[model samples]
Target: MEDGKIKGKAMVLSGFDQEESAREALEQALKEAGLAREAIGIIVTTGNGRKAISFAKGDVTEARAAALGAVFLYPTARTVIDVGAEESRAIKCDATGKVLDFAVNEKCAAGSGAFTEAMARALEVPLEELGPLSLRATQTIPMNAQCAVFAESEVISLIHSKTEKADIARAVHDGLSSRVVAMVRRVGLNTELVLIGGVAHNPGFVESFKRTVGLDDVRTAAEPDFVGAIGAALAAAE
Candidate 1:
């Protein structure tokens, strides 16, 4: 994911059904990144043969990796918010991204990058245009749906009403922010609130987040999207 300011990459070798293939993919990525091939870290999930692993050169991963590593470093961080492509997560962790308490909204696309992508498509715009376009809105149109289907309908209505596309975009950002902020509160708004995952790239979303949560400090890695991979790598380092 590219946030204009930061970029991250993650390769999940899911559906492999074999540890060997998974291991090969992991090794290849590490070698390509110029990381030591001997360095391996492992994390076992609830599913069989579905392991999350990481490889790096040092005692820990890189700085982006360290932000995720920080979660494992702190056993008391009860909340982790990860906003990504298909869904957004409010995870309660034990100082590690090892989810202890977690809530996710995957049933709908309203709060995910997918929703933003769809909107951008409907507006005949590119994803890179969203941030600057949203910043141009003189006023935010009200969008009241948490489900993507309903939100799409609302957006169409706005288009019919001749609402400025910028206003509509800002409204989408507002709606998503409200839902995610509620998720954070539901998971118990603790300090060290780490905001990771892909959607963290949206400047409007970030600004709306700061406003909605009344949080003076929000933590985001240089590469927000790859925090999970980085976390997996960090766990393996341990």
Candidate 2:
């Protein structure tokens, strides 16, 4: 995209093994885009695996990627909350997408997507069901554990007590939302907040997140999963 708009995009998860798989997936994406390696002028990578992406010319920090990507997707975006598999980030940025400040929570899975995955498994529901199930919750149930491992046990207890799955699901979303919002507040959350990352696909989490943060509206991309790569692509274009 150095002198052009994005012509193609693709994604394939390797489940944290290494960069080789990601590279293979990239090659596939490039193939789908009808381009060859020699057609590209530069390459940039981002995220934890960035250091291992041997073919890349350089890298960008995940915070910068998320911030810039949010602004690119939504120009009005002033704050971005990025939630990945193992961690979460809150980024404050200016109108031009320059990161002003940011905060992160990586000490535990409490605020991460892993937290929801674990609870979903415990509930014996498809992971995709968590959001909708929570939405149907007729009563509020607060979760007590911030540690995902311990929280899994608490979920079991809720099950043994015959608590409605919907209520339990909402409780789980509530717990994760609180932790994510804490990071957002630390970064001085303002109007035009955008939520990105794989977890953002969950409507339940989105609603819970907005309500917990006392916001009436939030922004998101149509296909947010590629925001980081898009940012890296933007860097390469520069």
Candidate 3:
């Protein structure tokens, strides 16, 4: 980020060596921006691997970073919901990105992107295609499993019962959304809901979450996955 706005962005997969991955991602970002390392100033890190980045000047909690990033992207955002591969969080904040309250579902894969990935595998569909496939669903088939392991089995059973893949996909997203909505409720839902994290890119989950929360105007940025990084940058700027 530059001049209080994003100038360039890059992403790399989190491999076994998190610090190495962070370095590679930073290098990519710098290369994309055509800047040398010395051109950069402060670095504030957030997320699960924040502590692994020894070069960072400071670190912030994931929830706080998410809140800051969401409010930065959408000034009116009062509630921030972030659903990643391993965890999902709901953060209540004001226009200034001050976190008032927060809740997280960290213990369950069923409430994270991992659940959708598992269901997608069970349906023999690629992860990226799952969302669009779910949009083709004609009806909502309630998914009973509350665990990812069992959810995969339940998806298989649906396949055996000749259920449409699109319906099954929708059911998977619905189940994930229900759990996310419950988490958001703990933090107190407010107007201008903003969704950040990799899962925000999933249209099926977005639609399901909007319906579950009874809000059609949920907001998201162009690159939802980078919100935490943007938040960290915002913190560094401060």
Whole-model lDDT values for every prediction: 0.63, 0.87, 0.91
Residues 1-238, candidate 1: write the lDDT tens digits. 1112112233553554555555665556656655554432333221123333332223332223323543753444456777777777776666445555566666578767788877777766788788678878899667877777777788888889999999988887788888888877766777767777778888767766776788776766556755665554544444
Relative to the true structure, candidate 3 has a C-alpha RMSD (angstroms) of 1.0
Q: With candidate 3 superimposed using the best TM-score fit, by how many Å does residue 225's alpha carbon deviate from the native? A: 0.5
Candidate with the greatest lDDT versus the true structure:
3
TM-score of each: 0.71, 0.96, 0.97
Better of 2 and 3 by TM-score: 3
Leading candidate by TM-score: 3
Write out the backbone clash pairs for model 2. Answer: none
State the weakest 10-residue window (summed lDDT) of model 2. Answer: 1-10
Name the better of 1 and 3 by TM-score. 3
Question: Stretches of candidate 3 above 4 Å error?
Answer: none
Write down the TM-score for model 3: 0.97
Error of 2 at 194 (Å): 0.6
lDDT per residue (tens digit) for residues 1-238 in model 2: 5354776777887666658777886788788779998898888898878888888899999999888777887888999889988889999999877899999988688889999999999999998999999999999888888899999999999999999999999999999999999888898879778889989988889879988998877776678788888888887787
